[model samples]
Target: MGLGKLLHDHAEHADVGGTIDHPRAYELAAEIGFLGRRREIFTRLAALSGVRPGDRVLDVGCGTGYLTRILAPIVSPAGRVTGVDASAPMVEHARRRAPGNCSYQVGEGQALDLPDAGFDVVVSSLAVHHIPAAERGAALREMFRVLRPGGRLLIAEFRPPTNHLLAQLVGMVSGPAMRHSPHDLLGDLIPAAGFHVQDEGDLPVMLSYVRALRPST
Candidate 1:
């Protein structure tokens, strides 16, 4: 089976909980209200993204289309939101739930099929971490290539824990995820990808939202 198919199997009933056909994300993030913390994070991204009504947006690892659907309205009528994930089941769920303004496809994060500089904004929430540690920097590079000058890339990833309690808890719940933690300097890696890292910080405190912007000339 291809990687996509393998991913599909692992994701069976893996998503949060709602869609009977599609698996739920372990985060159970969609359970939150549309105007809740997610909205707040995206609002900040919108401002930093320079995502006007007519700019194209790319959603990397857009599971179940939560953030993708949210971005559609903001960039609608003129702009479009494209969601890409490797899991067929996840893509199906996203397609069913997504409005016509959005499109979902089964694809890999490191090797996006989209053309260069095609998007004005590139965003991923709690998704980039799934990529293998060695290729995450390449994934960011791909995002950079697809983003137009001044396009924005916002990623919310799990940061290294400060205490053993949080670490232990993370190990228990997301231990498998630990393999993807490369310990790379995300602050500097964003810049190394050809885009200056405009902002680097933890967001929502508990969620560890890491955000960066690439300015266009």
Candidate 2:
């Protein structure tokens, strides 16, 4: 079985990409996959999110609350960071490590339980491809719905390496989900969801990101 299949819970919807059940194993894999630069990379992601000290932030598919933990200190004192994931186990694991300003719940990206226009920022990292392809549009729409006008959004996804051998190796390990080019995976989804595209570019460590804003008007 591929590493992805090994880490994924088979009980989850077969149509969905997969939900990780083993938090510790997933954490270890993430650390290894990122080459021990997970913290620095995630810190950059948090910065790209355009979150402020008083901005309410939401993290969709927040595996192990890694990004949420990074965001908590940024949105400290008064602001709150809420993380939602499809895996109950992952949510529970996140809850155990959550900071004072962070919280977590079991939820899916396509059908968020959050209120409309409730968040100033929404960020999802390495999570979009996990949503079933049919539901990805709905998930983007949900992100649009939960953000206040002019709210920022940052989405980061895996970028397959340019080297053919390395890309194939990544596919073999992570499954087909990570094999897609971020541009092809996200094409028109953000704009179709009513977000104004701000910037998009490749980041270090085989990551690609898109930043957008909810229209103020």
Which structure among the candidates has the greatest lDDT? 2
Clash pairs, candidate 1, are 14-24, 15-23, 15-24, 15-25, 16-24, 16-25, 149-216, 150-215, 150-216
Task: Please give the RMSD to the true structure for each candidate, in Å.
Answer: 6.2, 1.9
User: Cα lDDT for residue 95, model 1?
Assistant: 89
* lDDT (tens digit, per residue) of candidate 2 on 1-217: 5566667644234236667788888898789888899999999999999999999999999989999999998998799999999999999999999899899999999999999999999999988888887889999999999999989999999998999987777665566566678987888999999999999988887899999999999
Please give the range of 10 consecutive residues that has the lowest summed lDDT in model 1: 12-21
Worst 10 residues of 2 by lDDT: 8-17
Q: Judge candidate 1 at residue 110 and give its lDDT.
A: 84
What is the per-residue lDDT of model 1 for residues 151-211, given as tens digits with 9 covering 90 to 100?
7887766565667676665544443333233234244556778776665556552344445
Q: Give the C-alpha lDDT of model 2.
A: 0.88
Model 2 ranges with Cα > 4 A deviation: 9-16
How well does candidate 2 match the true structure, expressed as C-alpha RMSD? 1.9
